[model samples]
Target: MPLASDPIRALHSLLRSTLRITVTDGRIFLGAFVGTDKPMNILLTETEEFRLGPGENPNGRFVGQVMIPWKMITKIEAQESVVQTRNQLDRDVRAGYIM
Candidate 1:
């Protein structure tokens, strides 16, 4: 199947199902792909708290929230979902859903 035929599915294939997002301003957030708009903008929820700065001990950790704009994103890392989705898509295409 052409990559553009199913852009959302392609995104589901390309982007991390479990994303580790780092904001340009140096904040780190991780969560499931709750939502997104084209141009790669994203929305993530179910975030956990993380501590900033280079430190040996995590003493000043603060509760973090999800809802960062894509413009603030500096990096995104894909996790287990990459392999899982690829395998699943392969199966689906073999069954003729993706053609």
Candidate 2:
């Protein structure tokens, strides 16, 4: 699909960007936003899982790239969205979700 016409293609622009994703269970995942899908599922690389509350280390655990379901997501936080900023106009981002 052409970048001009592709939906969900903006996810590519976030490549290598840091993101903080919160799930329904109140756990937070901080990682690089790599991709997503039609259902709003997100793909994050170099992830860390954080539980809420102070005194709990923000950098508690590190995991590899994580694929989170749309239904499980409660929030997504990024410093900025490339799609919103419209930077890297020519970059092609691919969205992949297994299963």
Candidate 3:
């Protein structure tokens, strides 16, 4: 894991790919898999939420920029690799992604 905690990977990945993330609550989000943590909490942007939960409002809709808790992540599918452009790297550097 260790992919969460900031916006670098989220921003970079947002530029490159879309992700299908499923949560334990039976909610699924199709969006850019922007960030994740060691516990596998997820962050997504431009999301369409497929609500399978009990709540009606949360069922089958789109939500922008969502954070899924570590306890909630069930699965994630990425159709393509996340690209790391030079611009992204520069941003990462400025943001302290550098070691």
Off by over 4 Å in 3: 1-15, 52-59, 80-99
Instruction: For each candidate in the order shown, give its overall lDDT on alpha carbons.
Output: 0.65, 0.73, 0.68
Give each model's clash number.
0, 1, 3
* Candidate topping TM-score: 2
Q: What TM-score fits each model? A: 0.60, 0.66, 0.53
lDDT of 1 by residue, 1-99 (tens): 444466676566754366777888676676766777765677665665454878633443433446667788888765755656676776789799999
**Candidate 3 residue 67 C-alpha distance from true site, Å:** 0.7
Off by over 4 Å in 2: 1-9, 81-99
Higher-ranked by TM-score: 1 or 2: 2
In model 1, pairs of residues that clash are none
Global fold similarity of model 1 (TM-score): 0.60
RMSD in order of candidates? 4.4, 7.9, 7.8
lDDT winner between 1 and 2, please give it. 2
Cα lDDT tens digits for candidate 2, 1-99: 233455454456566788888999899998988888788778999899999698887656998889999999888876655444543344423232222
Q: Candidate 2's error at 38, in angstroms?
A: 1.4
Better of 1 and 3 by lDDT: 3
What lDDT is reached at residue 54 by model 2? 81
Tens-digit lDDT string for candidate 3 (1-99): 223446464445454378787888777888876676676667778889887546566556778999888777778776633433434555677799885
